[model samples]
Target: MEHHAPTTEFLGMTFNLSNVLMITIASAIVFILAVVTTRSLAMRPTGLQNFIEWVMDFVKGLIGSTMDWKTGGRFLFLGMTILMYIFVSNMLGLPFAIAIDSELWWKSPTADPTITLTLATMVVVLTHYYGIKMKGAKEYGRGFVSPLKFLFPFKIIEEFSNTLTLGLRLYGNIYAGEILLGLLAGLGGAGIAGALGAFLPMLVWQGFSIFVGTIQAFIFTMLTMVYIAHKVADDH
Candidate 1:
């Protein structure tokens, strides 16, 4: 938790170097996985294609559960992409971490508030954009005052709340996992008995972190769909 992300300047602006590097790596990893998963393009769809198709079906089901396929289908890519990217990014730093004193050179991008918050804000903004685009300004505006006029303020507040919760939930869980792992890593440096004592816990904790990463990714995806549904669902 005390580890500071790497910092650097680019074109006069300061940036978190560790985050930029991890984000780039995560993006590349996702792109490569996507290419590999779909490269064969088999009609029968075996191996990677089969797995990709299964993911597609999972996304489809997730969408169908929330809204019409027409509305939700368009977001399947967004949902799937976010799910994969966040999951992979969350898992990235679990196996190992690079640190020099208190400076963290590499870690999970999703564990950072900036990355998670940016993603949350972007998704919320898109929901508003699509809501107005699909339903027109008049109908979208009506959403704010639905049921009663007093709700306008609450509706406005809801946007910020949604964004904060979406991002913070992911950050909190991943950060906790990272912090616990760091403590365990410290235990490994103690003595022979400490090393033996910490080894099994570290291994078990890492596996649990993977589960945490996956659950957080899914939760983020599900909330994204819910937020979108609130904005774009015609019946809502």
Candidate 2:
């Protein structure tokens, strides 16, 4: 069955109800996790606190590797938030997807090009904003012409390419994973023999999908920091 997204028209604009609902759920999950993780500050952390601290430390390291701590420290929260949110979003569809009356109501938001592209655009925009704020507008604009004036057009092209690749890479991986998983699910429902045959492949694919989702989250966060470093670093 081909399930279509439930959408609505509002203020002369179209909106995907499924995407909106999933995005809201993902955001709420991230928010609740953050609150729970920080609800108590312990001098000696354990359990969830320890886990979140470790994740934060990992994000800190990512920032440090890209730019000096003085500059990158400010982005620690951003990096951590991005990592956690995208990870949660990626994992949402792995368990199972929900389609109600030919409308897909639940899935990974990152599987949609609209969501991924918006995220990429936001990250790229933030990098430029920070670059201007740190380097001053004049100095930042000079970046396009530095080393050689002819590089300006190429640099402009690079920005567009970066945004397209960053967004499409995530969307492609997740969308394909979900499609295959859906097929496997259909196979599992066929009959006893089909269930037996599909079980192992489904299980294996689910695990691989988890791995891919985690990698994609990390890659997106890493690239975000790298882009910011290129924009804001003095030596760049």
Candidate 3:
């Protein structure tokens, strides 16, 4: 693979540098945008502020759709953070990328398993934490065996499955899209014939990829809320 995650050692451990950089950059961009957008309040929003306020309302609606506002409102920050970060990270790779040897300096952070899995783990952990907080430990534990004790093992397995699927789903889609874009770029590098061949296809896929990225981010956000609802709902 031309685009491989760069590794570096730290404190007797190793980490993927490319993934780390992308994550950090994406986070900083989102943070800066948030601050800039809301720096001042106006009677009528304009430009960045208008767009950001719209995003907040859209995200809040998504949260409300999944669970009651009383319970889901607590995760508004988490939901918003994940949605904005993922969307921005996904778009980051749509431009140019630089990859040398086993080091990639540009790409979507979610394209790396480490980043996506860590995110999925955080969401899962929070769901369990909120579950225990909302309902007693005993009650939350009993949820695994709800309706029937025989289902306890399956319920336990579901937790692991959810974690795997949640991360892999985003990683798979974004990584595949990036791979295709990379191949298209390679083709265009050949000559005039190559450019002609790749042009229309590249244009089509680029537009579709953006749509795919947006949908994947939304799906991930929705699933986060759903997982939380399943764990923390009173009926659970």
Which has the greatest lDDT? 2
- Tens digits of per-residue lDDT for model 3, 64-169: 8878899989899889889999999888887767887747889999888878898999999999999999988998999998899999999989999999999999
Model 2 lDDT-worst window of ten: 38-47
Query: Residue 193 of model 3: what lDDT?
Result: 100
What is candidate 1's local distance difference test score?
Answer: 0.91
**Candidate 1 clash figure, as a count:** 0
Task: Estimate the TM-score for candidate 1.
Answer: 0.96
Which residue pairs in model 3 clash with each other? none
Give the alpha carbon lDDT tens digit for every residue of 86-190 in model 1.
988999989988888778977899889999999999999999999999989999999999979999999999999999999999999998999899999889888
Top model by TM-score, which number?
Answer: 2
Give the range of the ten consecutive residues with the poorest summed lDDT in model 3.
94-103
Which one wins by lDDT: 2 or 3? 2
In candidate 2, which residue pairs get closer than 3 Å at backbone N, Cα or C atoms, i.e. clash?
A: none
* Tens-digit lDDT string for candidate 2 (128-201): 99999999999899988887999999999998999999999999999999999999999999999999999999
Note the residue pairs that clash in candidate 1. Answer: none
User: What overall lDDT goes with each candidate model?
Assistant: 0.91, 0.95, 0.89
lDDT of 1 at 173: 95
